[model samples]
Target chain A: MTMKKIVLMALAACLALGTTGVYASQADDINALRHYFKKKFPTVPFKEFANGSYALSADKRINWESMRDFPPFEDHVAKGEALWNKKFKNGNSFATCLGNDVTKVRNRFPHWNAKDKKVETLEGNIVACQKANGEKPFGLKKGNIAYLSAYIASQANGQKVNVVVPDDKDAQAAYEAGKQFFYAKRGQLNLSCADCHVYSAGMYARGNLLSPVMGHTTHFPVWRGKWAKKKGDGFGTLHRRYGGCNKQVRAKPFKAQGKEYSNMEFFHASMSNGLTIDAPDYRE
Target chain B: MKKMTLKVALLAAMMATSGFAVAMDEDSYRAEHKAATEALNKAKKVGGEWRDSRWKKSTAVKVDGKKMSYLHAAEAYAAKGDYKNAMKYAGIAKFEGEMGYQQAMDQKNAGPRH
Candidate 1:
């Protein structure tokens, strides 16, 4: 081929390859993230990462073990159970919407909704279910939603995370959007979610231990001590934690269960595919 | 005696040309403050993305032990009749504000993973 034609072809090929982003599969990312954590903290058991900061720091583990023994979220879980079982004014219950199988329902959440063209989080789905059943939707940030999420997640203890991203273009777009949000740098701090969770895991930041990104999705409906002062027991969903992390980095947080967060949850949850669910987890 | 006369003459000449340097003109102060206010407005417009709704303020951290928020500092300096300092701070504020606004715009619609 002529040199001019060869150079033009090479340039076109480079542009196409660069724009396509190597296109790692969900499984590829999951394995790579697990391997990254394994290499980082080889001594810690793979499954123990689900315990969050406790999995790394000895002091945190001791405190977390004691906290887990009493489990301050017990009261919230009980309230959630009560809410779950409570009947709507129409004589139907949330149980009716989930086909009466509440035990495994949490695993099915944050699913891709083809018709709605968005990710449907467990918290959002619960509210949608309530609204559909003639009941008032639970608030998104905390309170009823936290209580409800606590109860639902409690039901699925020991079940492995089974988040899936379907083959649809929209589903792929959403999952990609979420992954982008997780890695994108923003705020005055100019830190991405990956900066701490991926690169700086196990490092101390302002006296707090940073946990690895792997298995972050394994636990949800956390009982955080920081929130205890303002909110008794301080139960919150994964998306709420996402917002808090964004704010911690000085970035403005998107609303919980909004399109941004729902998509982020989709990508984040898929990373914890085989990790056992340990909802109602505790954290400092 | 000649040295003292030259010093006084030079002082008078400096005053005539630069208006004592420290004493900024009223119209100039107003204009400087107005420009700073305009820059502050741009920063505010772009800063909403990083602002904390609960606190209703920019998420910008303190720089050199002082918050980088230029508008308030500019206003305070203007109120104290420190127009020279006000203008200087206003310029800094304008620079930070424009950078902040640009950063917000650049990332607002970005979603690719590259």
Candidate 2:
């Protein structure tokens, strides 16, 4: 055989091997889940219960506008409005960050930062503004800062997410890192984010349909049932959502406002770039 | 008639004893069980030493058997220094697995057994 033909054959063999490995891993995962279900409830049929645990129930879906009137998230929004109008310790409001109107800020945010080698979420940008003004940076996970951030993002509710990943290597690297984090497997289930969000999406896991991550960040300040009791009309930011996903996957969740999470938020928000915001939606 | 009644009583006693035997302390029995079963369970919880953080929970895939609890996998992963996955599995085992086990027990108790 010619040298070219041999090379092609070798490549084909490698591809076939790679395909088989992926299939075997998926099959193994399914079998393991089946066995887990069986051992826990021997009488419960595996096929029925397996999908039930992870499935998205009807209640988990979002109704964005309806939630806007709900309070403390609404109350938080009111507070954010107050904060936006309030001047910094430097006697200037966030309006000084850029000459643009404060109302339109969220749409332009989560922009690429060449200096940081990553995309900055709107919240991060806001904190930067506070820091630049010589004011104390608001804790990303807590207090009025998070609420105000969510409120600001909500102002762009009808506007589309338009974060641009520059062609430069730094932006590209951050995007790739974010992608890797999204697909990387963690937790005791040995499951990757793709395992459920991409592969098993639309399948039920405990009465919740695994939503495709495609347009996930289109919504913000979502009213999660899990947090409703605690926050009293609580709102979850992009960072908090990232933490929740990690917890669900059984990985040690990252801090709500850390670099890893920010990178993840950057990628997640970017994925929904064209979609409009749907803030304060209800979810199970 | 007496002979038949005695036989019935013996059968009833056997059934009662069997249930108790099965219900005997699970922890003690598990401790005495085969090492592979225990190891597999532990490994399932804490991922073995695969450096890739992505591979942190890979060992958990081994405990696919129903007989093993998430706790077993967590223990195994923890032993192997995969604390993140170990803790994750441990939480699942404690919450979801336990709830499932209890539900199963409830169903069994409610069901008619021949």
Candidate 3:
């Protein structure tokens, strides 16, 4: 073959491979991450990772057990239940907006919405549902939203994390972006979400133990002890904690319900698939 | 009385050397400001930011945000011709900013998993 022909052929091959490589199946990524965690913490049961730091430390487990006995989040859950059932001014309840049976609802969230070309969170859907029903939506952080999410999550106590990236190009791209965000280091600290949850799991920073990423998704709307100290609000959503973590690393945080965060939540939730729901969980 | 005189004289000399005993010229103010800014940049390189000053809960350095604010305070003092306070605040900002930088660098990528 001529040199020109050989070069052209090589270029064609490279472009082909690059184009094909763009579509990494979500199932493959989930398996790889799960395998990595399983290998790292071989002794810990896969389901137990849902317990977060408690799964890794015996001392913390004792405290976690005690904390669960009182269940500080009980009040929040109760409030959430009321909000979930409360009717809109039009005499339609949140149920009318969300449809019947919310028990398995949390499992379906952080899903790739091909139609919207976006990843949607349960919290976002709740807001959307309320807006659809003529009721004003709550903000993404604390208050009625947190309580509402807590209540909904509580109903799905045993439902597994089942976020999926469908076959659609947009859906796949969203998942890839989320995965990239997880690993991409940002902020002045130059720490990625993976740097803490994946690479540094079970380590200590600032007097707190870090939990493995394996079970990170199972819990949400956690009743954090540090957060509880603030008057009038103790509960926090997954995105609010993300904001706090970003600030801790000296980075400017994105808005709680922003696209980047939603993509991230989709990726994080995907990682914890098959793990049972454990929201209203406690944390330091 | 002799001892008291000696103490007063020593204090005056110390203050003069530290730039706390006299009004500073524009050049001195500029130099101090430049040094503070550079120190802040250095701090940022090791994982601090202008925003770190607002993130009071940052574990990297407790004084980082406070020190960053001092940079602003230093500039204000210099603008008012209070170079003594300006230099003092600048020095503090530099010290704390560097401390934050060092901590961030040392703890580079260190997390619970590690």
Candidate 4:
């Protein structure tokens, strides 16, 4: 072939690959996430990632497992159950508002609500559910709502995560926004979520080990040890953790259940599509 | 007392050398704050806005018993007619805004590493 022809062919091929990369589907992104972690930690089984940072460290896993014997979060679940069963003045309860099957709650969240043309999180629904009844909504971070989340999550403990990004344009856009937030650099550190979790997974920053992004969303309403001073119990929701991360990076945290976090939850949860839920998990 | 005098002398010398010796009346401070606000808005447009200062929870620096952002510090200083300090903080905030915008532009195409 002529040199001009060869060059033109190479250019066309490059353009084709670039365009394909740009338009890769959400499923494609999830597959890429799986492949990246698999390559990074070949010995680690994918299912074990439900344990967060423990998946990468044998010592941490041993400690985490010991904690599970008398799980600090067990009492919070009982409290959550109490709250879940408590009826509103209008004779409606979380069980009634959300439905009798609590098993389905965690699996259904971080979903694209077509009616609202926005992402709806479990916390967002709880807020709406409370308003629908004759009660004030709970705060997003901690207190009753987080306790309730911990309880509801405990019910779906073994259910596989199945967050979806629908084929609709707006749904795709929301997912894209979240994907962008994950990868795009933010804050004074000029670090993206991917920078630490994806690129530097298993590495330590100061005294803490950074966990991989894979299966990050399987856990929620964690009983974090550090929260003992602030939270009545050491419990916090995923959004609360998200805020803490943002603050650590010197970025302004988006409100819990706000567009930024809800959309992020959608993308973040989908990354762990097949991983079983491990809610109210303990974390340092 | 000698150490305090030396520290004050060093600060004055640094400020004079950093082009902060110019007129720092309310009008100048306002002009600087306006520029910082505009830069911050621009950075925010691309979702690249940085914290106005290190988090108050992060640092020992405080203003009126509360740690404030560089932007807020500028405002507070201006409110007290400490125009030089106001201008200085406003400049730092403006620097952060521009840096944040540049960082966003650089990472506009950031995605999966693999």
Candidate 5:
């Protein structure tokens, strides 16, 4: 063969081989992802369960009326209302912190902190409010701040979640970290949040339909049926739910209101960005 | 003769491709159907036992036997691998057991192996 023709043929062969290699690598990556998902979520028999038909049980539905007419949280809300109206040690109520109108203040919260470059939740905002007013911060656990913030958030019941992550690198990183926390596997079950909420959602585990975590945050201060004796008490906040997720995974639950959970809550709340609040929901 | 040969060649090509496609389609359908049916049967079997026990417990006052109740008979039948009678007696036991006994009947009706 002529030298020019031989060179052209060699080049063509190399291109074909290179294309094949690229395609092979792509196929391998896809297969790896499939294998990882299958191993991680072995209990989810996707083909058999189909979509939406996986977790239909008779008793998982919550009776909303039973939740509202009860105790601890309801009482807490009353306390919060008093606090809202009561003057602080400085003769200033929380109402004085944001123009004496608690209703409009709650919806404006969970805002993007430009310096921190992350979405700070309502709880964080409350702490900031306390600090700016020279008051001690309420504990994130079963305490005044938790109750007051919940009650305050409840005021914006019909208001949509409106967290705005700034279009910056730090904001992006925080958002990604939150997403990772959701999908990353933890606990003795070696299961990720997505395994139950995304893959096996609507499917029964024991007797409950695994609810989709999407729009879940809308309902806060939930009255859980299993713990109904507490009555009107809020069972899940971002931190509380994080602890529950950790327990399910068999890992020691994180400290209430810690950074890991805060970031997770930021991401989780952001997911329900436009969904209206469904606070104080009832759940089994 | 040339036209006839061309027609035969086209027919052979079409038949080869169509046959392969049809076979693949059928195999895929069968695999999916089998998986679905297997899942359905499993769920139905579980549901059936639960329902039977629930029914028996809800209707306990109707039975008058001092002899082994259908629940006991169902347990015995299940032990012998006689699912037909086991299922029958389980249904009857469910219809004759007390309200609190439904859970026990359900466990019994599940049979030993599962």
Candidate 6:
């Protein structure tokens, strides 16, 4: 080949590689994340991460398993189921937007909305559905919204977390934004999400153990014993936990289901791809 | 005698500018307080605002009376014409805000360590 032609071809290849990022590095990001944890925790069975701190502690596991019979979140889930059937002012219900089969709705969200050009969350859609039906939207963090989500999650109990990053550029950018947010140090404490979840997994932060990133998204709308006593109902969506964590680090929290957090949900959910969905779970 | 007068005048001006003079007056205190607020706003604009940077203004007489929030204390001091205390609190807020902004910039490209 002529030298000039070879140079032209090389330039073309570089252009194809592009400025924002090529998929080569990002495509395997989730896989590499899982592998890193697998390497760090050789003894943990891949499925056990759903149990979080319990997975790392035998004593904690016993305590967690004991709560399985009469989980504190059960009542909250039933309340959610009732909300599912309750009609809006316009007479439409959650079943109108989400189908009668609510059990499968949990795994379907925190997905890329190609048409909207942003990450769409289950809670966001719930609010949207409420608005579309001419009803006041529920709060995103706790209360009836969390209870309804808990019910939807219970329905999807055994489903796998299936977050995806599609081929679209906006979708990729959203994922990248979330990844940056996850790692970026913020607030007075100057701590990132990865600081505790990735680097210090199974380690104690004050009294509570920092759970790993693995299977983190599998459990959601959790009912915490402490939170149950504080916030009217202890059942809270994952976004509530996100807000709480950001506050704990002394950082100002982004609005739940807003672009910043929804994108974060996209990234973190993808990291937990293939993990079983275990919703309405209990935690200390 | 003229030279001596000039030397004294220069020393007096230096002292004023070097913060060896009496505490700031209302106008000077206003300038300092404004600067602290601006730094805090800048940090907030970049989404790097920390919760500790400012707190909810309490209704209690103790904290609402400029006991906890540095900005609040600065305002209370300024109202009482305690420019020394006002300036000190303003300086603390300014430093913290600038630190928060610098941290945001430093972490612009923050990503996975490994």
Q: Per-residue lDDT of A1-284 in model 5, one digit per residue for the tens?
A: 89999999988998987852442232242234345534645665422221122223333322334344553367666766776776667876677666566668666655556686656776676667688778888766445765676677678787776655556666656655666666665433546666786667667788666865545677665545555455424454557666666666543355666556666676666655556775555556
| Chain A of model 5 scored by TM-score | 0.70
What TM-score does each of the candidates earn?
0.74, 0.56, 0.72, 0.86, 0.53, 0.85
State the local distance difference test value for candidate 6. 0.82
- Candidate 2 DockQ, CA atoms: 0.02
Worst 10 residues of 2 chain B by lDDT: B105-114
- Model 5 DockQ reads 0.01
What is the C-alpha lDDT profile of model 4 across A1-284, one tens digit per residue?
99999999988998887963566688899888888889889999999888889988989889889988889888888888999999999988887778899888888988998989999999899989999887999999988888899899889999999887887889988888888888888888878899999999999999788998888888888888788867477888889888888877777677798888888888898898999998888888
Top candidate on lDDT is: 4
DockQ for all models: 0.18, 0.02, 0.12, 0.45, 0.01, 0.53
- After superposing candidate 2 on the true structure, give the runs of residues whose Cα lies further than 4 Å from its correct spot: A1-72, A231-233, B1-114
Give the docking tier of candidate 3. Answer: incorrect
Error of 6 at A31 (Å): 1.6
Between candidates 1 and 6, the lDDT winner = 6
Residues B2-107 of candidate 1: C-alpha lDDT, one tens digit per residue: 9999999999998887765545454576676676556546645654334321123543334335554455555566777777666765665555555556665665
Runs off by more than 4 Å, candidate 3 = A1-22, B1-50, B53-114
The stretch of ten residues in a row with the least summed lDDT in candidate 1 chain A is A19-28
Q: B1-114 in candidate 3: lDDT tens per residue?
A: 999999999999998876643544556767867876777778665544434433334333223244335666676677677777777767766666666566556655342222
In model 3, pairs of residues that clash are A200-B112, A200-B113, A200-B114, A201-B113, A203-B112, A203-B113, B53-B65
Interface Cα root-mean-square deviation for all models = 4.1, 16.1, 6.9, 2.0, 18.0, 1.2
Note the chain A TM-score of all models in turn. 0.90, 0.72, 0.90, 0.91, 0.70, 0.91
lDDT of 2 by residue, A1-284 (tens): 99999999988998888852442232243344345434544654422222222223434323322443453466777777787878988798877874457658777766677876667667777788898999888876545665777667667677766666666767656665665566666553555666776557567778666765545666565656677677544566768777667667655566665666776666666655555665544555
The candidate, 3 or 5, that scores higher on lDDT is 3
Cα RMSD over interface residues, candidate 6: 1.2
